[model samples]
Target: MHASSRRQTNCCRKPSTSGAKAPDLGNYAMSLTAALNTALMGLSTIQAQTGVTSGNIANAQNPNYTRKMVQLTTPAVGGDPMAAVVAAIVRAAAPNLLQDYYGATADYSRLSATTDQARQLAEALGIDDTGGGQTPLQSRLTSFEDAVKRLEATPEDTTLKALVVQRGQELAKEVNRLASQRTTLQSQTQDDIRTGLDTLGDATKAIAGLNAKIIGQKAAGMPTGDLEDLRDAEVAKIAGLVGVRTITAENGAMSIYTDAGVQLVGTTAQSFSYDSTTGTIRNTNGDNVTAGFSEGSLRASLDYLDGSAGALTSSDGNVGAMEKFFNQLNSMARNIADVVNAAYGSNLFNYTAGDAAATLAIDGAFTADPNTLDATRMGAVQQAMRNTTLTATQINPAGEPNGLSTANVNIFGLVSGVMAYHARQVSDNEAARDSAENLQANVEQKFRNLTGVNVDDELAQLTVLQNNYAALAQVMNAIREMFDEVISIGR
Candidate 1:
């Protein structure tokens, strides 16, 4: 062996040089490992991105859908120059615009509810106002007033008195029916609100469980973006039922709150329970309900119906516009009864007097009894009641043409005003609900843009990773060729 060979034989190792066969092969192995890792990471990115796009497309038809996005972070690897390491796939943080949308939802819901209640009341009162028969309450009032004027012409006519009694009964029946209908609608509204809250809470709990699953997988360096999109879809659905705000934590966990700032999920889930029968809503601890962060339409409806109706005040101390209406109706009924009684000496059409309002209620169903009294007197009384204006000038009593006393039927103004106001409110709410639906559509579109999966983007990336992986393999082949040449020379 020459000096270099002798030294090589004694050292029992290859020389350290860039072109050394063994060292070059080791370098090739390292390069291949790096390239392989890069390819794998690129593949994962493509898959995650694809899943997000798929989710967006799937929920396009859903009105309450919110979009989802995948988040990527780099991983630290030992000093390897060529490897690509992906730390985890995360869901996008919620947007600030959602807060604004939720607030609008709350307002619209309440307002719409009030509007709806009013509309229904108006419909019940037959206030289309197009034809004489269309506005039953108004027409009925006119008929009664006409009867009273006829009675003035023939106060002693028994047939006219009977007609007046019949007309009075008809008006009383209509008023009673309206009051009962309002009570039924209010009860139904309460039930709907309670049921909605229960559904919302159940959804929140499910999302919390999903959060745990997603974070656990992420910590293990797995692709959890697909599952994350499902969770987000569910959350968005829940959002439409109630307003929800979210907070992202350091460990890939999320905490949820209601628009009202009540926590739904964190260290533990704060859930709600609703009684369908009683129409009561409460928290997991069975406490009375609070709106919390729920910004959904259900809460909106409750606030609108309750607040607007409750705000209506009448001359009487009763609260709620609906109650005011009932009070006015009762007052009118009393006034009518007093007038009729003074003229005919009988309590024929009085709603129950104070403290015993229940008994004074006339049956909503009316039937005339012609045999009980003078028909002419009854007819005159009925006509006067219908035309009786709230103003004193409308009445003629005890030989006084303008005397306000002894005049009955002024309730026409109160009944018409209260019923009409309620109806207009309902119509307004219907319009508001339509507007809210449009807003919800716009919000969903925004969510889609942020979080939707684009298959084209993933496919493009896949092609790039494939080409790079092929290039790395080619480089390995070239390195092998050089090693083969070195081996041949030694041979």
Candidate 2:
């Protein structure tokens, strides 16, 4: 009886702690949800980073390509630490050191191109034989002039006269040909400018479209990285077409501007127009357009064609210096003939005679008395033709023929100088651009290290996710088994 009473008392005491605590179901569910989101976000980020890197590598060989990068942000969650969201790629932080490299490169390229062409043009004339220089133009001009001089020396020599006439005609034809080539180059430059403008317009439209898509998608709680990359790619293309300065807004939009600080694209798409006849590019309202290229190629091209180095018009309202040079050559040729005819009593050189009546007809092209033909005058004409009033209209205002008045300077000389400079610039910048490209590759590798997808990583994550799913399945099985046991016991 004593033992029974002791057991009863112990049972009655029944450990002061009351009931069993329920499992923290909400905490477990939240942890699993957070982990799942993290894994998904990581996968997305890795894929996006890979895409960006691949795009950069793909365009590595392209002269017009700019490198792209990836942007990431923390997803909006309180408990998740590993979750990531890919944001739009911000404009790359291209080093100004590289820009300087590019700018120098452009200057040199323009110089080289101009100089080389000028040298060739000089050679074409064949008269610039300060030494035994190999210039066809200068030599030919000298040969023609020598023939004229020889005829002057022996006026009765019909063979010499015929020779002078033949050589003169040949020299004239050559000068005309060279002038035509220059004109063609100018026309091509204009076309290039027009094309650049049209391209900018297209790029702007694409960028604007992408911006719209990205903004809308972001609002819908979708990732905007792909759309941002598309927009960045377009912007990079535009940079090659025309150097541009880009600014990023708080709203995740990018704005592009010209070197002159004119806005090209903003919230709305802007339009550009090309005038085929004038070979000019402008905004729809006809404002002269400036390039927004961060690199030097497009800017160099523009400078070569219409920038300060090759300005078509001056502040004083003068026409193109190059055009003026050609025109003056034509004028001087006609004047020389007129003077020779007036003084010596002969139409020895066929000059049409005046600005209106005495047109400069060389190789079937009607030009003013002073035209590009003057490039050959000194080599083809006798000393008498050298007599002239060197006026502003006759020569460049700076007093040399077309302002390239140095002793070694001639029409061809200018072209040579500019071309040479341009070539050097191109060579150096290309090297730097290559280096920058390499840096971009390094950055990409770093990015790959940080965020790129590895098969190993993917497999590991997949395993973790699979195991979690298996655990959930096992828990469900256990719960079902327990419920069955409860039913059996009741039965």
- Strongest candidate by TM-score: 1
lDDT (Cα atoms) of all candidates against the true structure: 0.56, 0.51
Residue 419, candidate 2: how far off, in angstroms? 12
Candidate 1, 1-491: lDDT as tens digits: 49989887879975668764343545655654565566566556655555555665576555444445455565546754433334444544346655555545555554555555555555666665545343676666667667666765776776766676566667666666655664576666667676666777677777788888878987788766556656665666566666677787866677877767767778667777655444345777887655463356565444433323223422211114344444445554555566555555455555564421222332233234544555445554654455545543233222211102323335566445545555555566677678876786676456555644445654565466566656656665665666566556555
On lDDT, the leading prediction is 1
Model 2 residue 335 lDDT score: 45
* CA-only RMSD, every prediction: 8.6, 9.7
10 residues in a row with least lDDT, candidate 1: 397-406
Model 2, span 1-491: residue lDDT tens: 99999999998885755577745555655555555556556666666666555555555554333445567888565563565667665334343433333333433433433343334333333434535453444455567667767766666665665576567566556545545555565666566656666777898999888777877777776656556657756765565555556776756677877555667788886787655445344675668654433333444344444424345344311224334345445544544445444444444456643322223233322132222222333333454444433334433433322332223333333334333333343455455456655655554455334433344544555466456546645655665565555456545
